[model samples]
Target: MRSSAVWRALPRGDLLLTSWPWRSLAYLITGVLLGEVVLLTFLATLFTGAILATVLVGIPLLLALALGGIPVAALERRRLMIIDPEPVENPHRRPERPGAREWLLLRVREQATWRELAYLVLLVVLLWPVELLAVVFGLGAPMSMILTPVLRAQTGDVRVLKFWLVTSDAEAFAALAVGAVWLALALYPLTLLAAAHGTLARAFLAPRESETGQRLAEITRSRTRLVEAFEAERRRIERDLHDGAQQRLVALTMTLGMAKLTEGAETAELVGRAHEQAKLALAEIRDLIRGIHPQILTDRGLPAAVADLADRSPIPAEVSVALPRRLPEAVEYVAYFVVSEALANVAKHSGATRAAVTGRLDGDLLVMEISDDGVGGADPSTGTGLAGLADRVSVVNGKLMISSPVGRFTLLRVEIPCAPTDHSK
Candidate 1:
């Protein structure tokens, strides 16, 4: 695949390239130099132990112990930064609920854990030699040419590294300089690759530190804000009732009571008018309360809640809630509001005689679907009531999708996350 396409497709592939060693032999020369650097120090340590065996074995063992923990934490942070960043919560977080050592062990057995370990082991072996070769490639390459003519003044000419392989000396400064310059330049990429390997190795070995406490605090703050917002809405409803409709209804009842106390033709006429006004006021009060929070929802749960809504709807509504039991309150609430609004829309606008409300739990989601076989032209752009419902669902991390193609069935589907186990409990 094209590199541009790969990065664009997902963050993980980008992370793999930016972090992991080049997964190809095309990176071989550079990687080998890096690999050699890492392995050499430890091998030397191990070798020294054969001579002074204790020093050799003990040194690498101690070195491993000291630096082993650093790499893993760094790698995890790097991977996270490359991928989802802030919106994605840290997956390294352990389950918030309490569990056992066995569960922890099982978690440690996952693929990412082993891959990180492999990266760390590779780093330890390459750390020293890669660093050394890189220094040689970077500086030695430049130095050989820069000093060749000048150095020839000092030694007349120095011999090549012919102790074993070359078995011959360079005649002039150019000859000795050329070999050294070429060797060093050739290894430059490998030197850089070694440094990269060492860095990645240490990073992958370190355990990822958890921000569980911080994240839980954030969750608590968010939940608190949600709770406060809900309460504020309730307060607004209470105020509306106390100052507006409630006062009007009380005044209407008083007028009717006074009218009933009179005993005349005028009194009878006044009482009838007052009675009509009182009834209107009462209906307004009922509608207001339903607007605030439907009592059917709290008392009977979602199925009966939706059924009551259907029963009162202006349009004939067929309600189907085959969920044998109640769903989680959060899920049920979103579903209830969605279905209620949908039915209200049908009654107010959809000229069709019939509508249907379907509620059920599908896997981890609570799905409430309302459809009307009416003149269907629900365009979300025109600021339909469904648009508000969609935004409300988003607040709860739910999804609302509406499909009301012209002259087709108008369907409003609200899916809210309420995992089965959560609702089951």
Candidate 2:
């Protein structure tokens, strides 16, 4: 993997042959040009807006000037890619809704907006000119000297950068050799300066450390919401199937059974078959409801749910969960499914005679492990089921670890950080 910073990407002892030095020079040159433009535009708009403030015409102009850094910083970010291949994330958060008022309000309120403005001010007043000078002296002078031989041949007598006269080919070639040496030495500082400039831009323009953390927190919260929503929808479907379809199927089965008992010998067999089909349909619906979101898991929590799974597993399974109380619904749901799937995998593939599931709340973490004594090689890549389970665990900021060495026991472990629910509730 490539390092995000260009300085880190630079190969040691190969400055001349690599593209980094050229990229640095280009980055500096562009910064200089961009800075000059920003400075001129800034002054023009700022003073004009100030002068016209009383007239009401300048109000919009001032607002524009205030938010001007957004576009400027956006350009800078794009330019930053030249020297720093690392992505510079914009610190600004999206508005909750799309509207000019919301956008401007959010921008004005955000610390990132003000930070960008400060960066623009710094760039206009100080940084860009410094970069300009460095590029001119560091890269420009050496390049000019390297062209010494060409200049002397063209003019027969040429003043080298107006510093010295070079009339002879020998003198020009000597200057060329010196310039080559100078260029090699100059590239180091050039790269360093560009790297520094990129770092400075990043400091003000990129998201702050706290902001990054906040974004991560927001993402976690949003993911949790999505998971909650998904679970609720599943439960809704389960309720519909259990109450509506299952009730109708049960009534049909009872009616057919009664018909079989009451009917003559000619119709008895037909009614019996119809009654059996209704019962099967009713059973299947119940299974579908359980698969969607088991009511037992909801009512009795994880311990009982694991026990239920153990009782149903084709392979002999033991459950030992030491939770004294219920956990959050999402946590219980995820844990239950992980154990259920692990046992299913064991029964189907592991040839395991016995499987054990253990769960306990250790500190804030809900820890669950499933182990099977069988020929063991569990690879999530071979099937989507395990991969999907892993994703489900991650949605709650949990981790899934699978240790299934070939010809050994397969152990699947999961840890989720959450405060246990108050059983009193």
Candidate 3:
């Protein structure tokens, strides 16, 4: 169905009239050029890196060589557009942090990176040379024979393919006819070769079926975590309402009933007590609502909300959040809870005098760090909120990192993507 589908176009009667042959020719030609450059670069870098390995100066060059396939594969994928209309998706995953080190570590660990290296090696050592030969024999030989008449006319006689000699105009014209037929037939094979090459490139460059399945599994796990977190949160809210505000409301009702059944000074005292109970119940309900989703977060965004959290923390907590713009509501919501839960942990478990919450936008990531000068042997397995925090973060495709030395400090760092996510998934 694709207009650029070379395999489909090969069987058509108008194959020669279409642009498929020219496109295939261009693709193969460019591939040969690219392969030559890759070969030279690979050899030079390998030799230099090997010579300088003792001094460690070539370590980076060697690393670059290892990662060289990434760029080569990217260019080849683009070149494939000449014959393959289907786009090849890059199989690399985004690094959790914004750094060259993190990016390099992630790339080296991915199977896609190694596959690309294999593809590059095959392309330079085998594929390009074969393509060069195909182009030369399939296209060049026929064109040369077709030009035999012109050569004979220019001089006295011409040799077709350096074998058959053509002296008279009739012999030259006969060679030309044969050459035309050969050229016409050769195009089909050439186009098919290009299509085969594209398929190989795609197999190496695009995400494999297994990788796609793994990604789907990861998404399913993250979604399940999100669902479990939501359920736990709902239960917490229910518990808080039942044990705090509902109990207070019931007491307030009882106090009012007692006041109505009494008289005079007793009545006034009971009414006054009932009014205080009613106010306490209202305050408890408001606190519960705020705990669920703070009004300040919805109104003024993350900075204001975090600053409010700092003000409310039992310890002297410093807040420094500077965002370029308001983030997606879900991101802000998750960020707020991460800070809230982190601060609560600090207050309850850290035994620290002070804590700080800092946030900034590192490229497209929202990087947040909560640090405290506490006796820090914080363990996620110790029934603390760190595991819950990690689960919550994973729901938004974010990362949670914790650093806590036995007697040092605890630092909770979270990196979340700034892009909006479909949480419904």
Q: Identify the leading candidate in terms of lDDT.
A: 3
lDDT of 1 by residue, 146-259 (tens): 455555666654433333122223444455567566644444354345334434533444334344455467567656655766786789888888887777777777877787
Per-residue lDDT of model 2, residues 156-210, tens digit only: 8878878888978999998899888988888888888888888888888888889
Better of 1 and 3 by lDDT: 3
Report backbone clashes per prediction: 20, 0, 0
TM-score-superior candidate, 1 or 3: 3
In candidate 2, the residue pairs with backbone N, CA or C atoms under 3 Å apart (3 or more residues apart, or in different chains) clash, namely: none
Candidates in order, TM-scores: namely 0.42, 0.59, 0.70
Better lDDT candidate (1, 2): 2
Q: Model 2 segments beyond 4 Å from truth?
A: 1-4, 7-11, 50-54, 152-156, 251-425
The per-residue C-alpha lDDT of model 3 at residue 15 equals 88
Runs in model 3 deviating more than 4 A are 1-41, 70-111, 126-195, 206-220, 349-353, 375-382, 403-407, 419-425
TM-score of 3: 0.70
Q: Pick the candidate with the highest TM-score.
A: 3
| Residue-level lDDT tens digits of model 3 in 29-108 | 89889988999999999999988988999888887887888999999888989998888877887654445777889999
Q: Show model 1 residue runs off by greater than 4 Å.
A: 1-244, 247-284, 420-425
